[model samples]
Target: MPHVFEVGELTRAIKAVVESEFPFVWVRGQVVNLSRPGSGHLYFSLRDAEASLAVVWFRGAQGGRISAGGERYDPLTGEVYDRPLAESITDGMEIMVAGRLTVYAQRGVYQLVAEVVQEVGAGRLWLEFEALKKDLAAKGYFDAARKRPLPSHPVRVAVITAPAGAAVRDFIRLGRERGHGAAVRVYPTLVQGEAAPAGIVRAMLRAVADDWAEVLVLIRGGGSLEDLWAFNTLDVARAIFAAPVPVVTGVGHEVDMTIADMVADVRAATPSHAAQLLWPERGMLAQRVDDAELALRRIIGTLLASRERELAVLARGLAWLSPARRLDRLAESFDGVDKRLVRAGTGYLDGLSRRLADLEARVSRRFDARSLDAREDALTRRVERLTAAARMFVADRQQRLELAGAHLAGLDPAGPLTRGYSLTTVARTGKFLRRETDVRPGDKLEIMVYEGRVRAVVTDGGPDAGDKS
Candidate 1:
């Protein structure tokens, strides 16, 4: 009888045989039934007509997207292989997968554990793109510090794009509709295909050499990676870097970004956006002007009102300093001084009289007839001395009073004015004009004398020639 084995054992035995025989293999086919679960393990079916093989690409595996002449790494064994694989393996792409043929022990099924995946034909282009991007980045071509600011309101804009394309038309149309009066000069050029790089370089050079516009705009409509590949060329990127004027790039759609966009001073989302950026809308500009004018008017009105209030205050002050007012104040001060002097004199005299009476009373009370005679003589002598002292004090006080009165009279504002000496004050402000700077040309000055005031205008003046006296 033939020996019989358990089902699991039999499956394991067959798996070992297949894996040992074809430990590593290369399969080329269209990807299908791709499933990437939460494990980050990529699962798909590699199928070519009659045959189909299950393949798995684990995340963080040794292998990455394969490029032409790039090294291939084994995901399962962590070993480098001769055959390279593409970094990304997606459904519907025709790719060459290099991995180890392995057994799924639990399910007891055979599958290819993909380590490397390479795009069938476009691997070289992708390699070149990545290599150039790395080189340019190393040279600081994509540095943010190198980027320049766009002009706030570019009066003249030079657009480099295909003349008949929608990009140029869109740019021009937007400019005409909204760009106040910005001039849009067009330099027609090919934006794609093999001749595109050379055409773009020439056009950029021409725009810079001729100083065509204040700012240069490079724009094109949306297309696939290959369709927009021309913008990614090294020549076009260098030209953009070397542009004399600020460059604004609006290539392809919003999702697509090329090397030109990276190197440009500004990147817009679309051709229409580029136009809007290069020019300000006429209505908006007009509104801005109107706002500025209104603000200026408001500021001027406030300033004028403030000056008017100041002038009014000065006029009021000048009125209060008039001759009549000054005379009235002086008269009131004189009356106060006279009353104080009279009160002081009367108090002193009363105190002296009281002292004399007290001294006489004390002598009468304490002295006998002979003593009284002697005391009376002494008292009379004392009286004479006191009288003399009182007379001298009165004289002194009288002299001081006369002096004070003379000083007060001299302080009279009318005193100087009455002597033909005029008091000059600033025009309209009543500020005492002491120096030449106090009054400028065309200034109206008030000249006040004893009789009245006169208004005079200053035609010309110089620094005072020192005090003569």
Candidate 2:
């Protein structure tokens, strides 16, 4: 009899043969019967019109073999990708996949263990895009150092887009609603189709030649990759690069990016977003203006208050240095001196009278009646001389005192009031009104005559001042 193998042994032998025969291969077909279970593995069938093959892409092998290899790095693009291939897969989509061939021992069936998967049609476009991107990047077109800063307050902006597109309309509306009074000029262009690249380049060049805009905006609505391919053209990219003014691009939705977006000075998610980046919010700007006005008022108020305090200090100092104040001080000194002079004169007279009485008493005790008479006559002569001398001294002091009083009276500020001249002063501040400009109409005034002060309100402040009531 012929030798027979066990079921397990047969399955194992087939698995070894299939894995060795086709270790790695690439397949192209329409995707069908796709399923992703909780095991984080993708199960799908790739079928052409005639044949179908089962495929399994374990999660570990989608981006990279995490434990077996490092992160998924693409040598062609010089970038790392962490996305799962399943994310791009859909039923009935034409896809190309590459993986190793293996046989499942449990089911004893052959399948493809896919490592990479991409849509066929889009993959070609992606390859072109990547090649261009690599070339541009090598030439420093995508360098951050080549990028420019946006203007803080752009006064003139040129918009390049389809005039009838909703993207341009939204941009214009947002600009009007939120911009800081910028003059927006639309440079209408075709943003799609085979001629779109040339149109965009022309629009950019025209806008630059006009030199009317501080910045240029290139914007378009979201669309399929083919629809937005114009922005990825070399002509458009070069045109944007050679623009004299800074260029801002808003080509599509946030998920979409193009070469124009990369080379632009700034990139925005949508046309409306570009407007927002260019101009500040109207309400927010108004609030800032109001805040600035309030701050200015506060600064002015603080300055005025500081000046008023200084004026008050100067006024007090002026009052202290006034002639009238000096005159008052002089009068007080004069009064003090006069009182001291009177006291000294009265004391001297009392001492002389006491000496004379002592001399008369001595004569009464020592001389007889004849000698006493002679002595008395001599004492009377001396007394008369003393009295005459005292009279002269008193008369001299009285004359000197009168002279000083006359000088004091002349220096006195109030002396003029005693005459016909009257003094006018501000009733509110008690400041002397020396000039016509000192008072304004409706100011209260006080008039000082010989008797007393008269209160009045200024009716006219002119060369000839007039007051009433």
Candidate 3:
């Protein structure tokens, strides 16, 4: 089969086929042999355990953290720049690259021209993980003080997992075989995808609100970084941290470590390992039960033997005496003991009755005395009040008499008369002249003496009686 064409024409035909067959598709891989070109383009190989794919992103796009211009070189690689220089990205980071899948025509090498790039960083999932851990820590949720011991015998086990997956089947089978007698509730959801984080959050909320499960088991089968990316979301991490019941996370193969594993109360390497952790082997449990039975039987036998020995000792003490005489004496002794017991009991009862009666009588007497004293005090207070009221009434009468006397003295105008004073008046009018200056040359006044009345005329405006009136 050797039909030949010109070299350029052949190359052109091959290029056309490549472009037409594969337009553009999203490819996922790990970062390897990574480089940041001077122009700020990322050149790296995205590979898994299987094979590697070449990927590139422009500087304006995601040439690395903090915007690439004027950034110093990384000493490890000594390159002009680093792709995804953000703290979030590292060499071993698992990620998904989305861009046009293109192949170099001459070299036949394929590479993705990335339009957008994000680090499948654990901290993204670990962000929720750490946040929830902080919250729970502050609230003493994960404190040793609050931890409840696992139930020795769990009647029911609630599994929060994807249905029909390897995790669910393994748990149920292991649980049943181990004779755990556990009623397993499989709550299924997408383990990894855009929906996974939300699904995990809802399951956790419902479990806490409803009190539905005793313990929770979260499991996912092994997968590549891109396939398992959802488990790394913050929502999923927090959900595990916030779950009320103790959570056991069984995720990834032995190699893959996830944030869920770290935050959960327990981490199982595989879904099968998770089941084994919850329940042990039935044969081992049966052996333990048998051992317990044998120990209990030995203890019971020892107790019975001790009782028999006590009975035998008592019997030996009663051996071989004069039968009738002994019997009579024993009967009499038993009667004496009975009489003494009765007397003791009767005496105790009588003493108790007397004490009770004395207490009751003292209480009654105290109550009666207190009541009578209160009444006497009240009566004494009333009597004192009545005496004070009488005194006040007499004093009030005395005050009234004193006021009447003052009124009478004022009406008599005798206060001035008692002081050896006399009155004068103008002869023409009834104006009393206490001062000689009050009288004018033409005025006349009248005056009332202590005993009678007089009228006179003013003869002069004299200064005073002492001044030759």
How does each model score on lDDT?
0.79, 0.84, 0.66
Question: In order, what is each prediction's RMSD in angstroms?
Answer: 12.1, 12.8, 39.2
- Which residue window of length 10 is worst by lDDT in model 3? 73-82
lDDT of 2 at 90: 81
* Maximum-lDDT candidate: 2
Q: What TM-score does structure 1 among the candidates reach? A: 0.53
Candidate 2 lDDT tens digits, 313-344: 99999988998778878889999989988987
| Distance from true location, Cα of 99 in model 2, Å | 9.0
Measured by C-alpha RMSD in angstroms, how accurate is candidate 2? 12.8
Clashing pairs in 1: 64-87, 65-86, 65-87, 66-85, 66-86, 66-87, 85-116, 85-117, 86-117, 86-118
Highest TM-score: give the candidate number.
2
TM-score, every prediction:
0.53, 0.62, 0.42
Q: After superposition, how far is residue 5 of candidate 2 from its true place, in Å?
A: 20
The deviation in Å at residue 426 for candidate 1 is 16
lDDT of 1 by residue, 1-469 (tens): 9989998888889888988998887788999998878887788899998999988888766343342334343332222334334335567889877778988878877899976666654444545677888999999989999888987777788889999999898888888888557787788899989998999899888888887688999999876456778888999999999888899999876556778888898999778888877877889889999999999999999999999999999999987889777877877887888789778877988988998899778978888988999988988898899889878887887888788888878877668877789888886567988877665667788888788888888877634523321
lDDT measured at residue 85 in model 1 versus the true structure, 0 to 100: 42
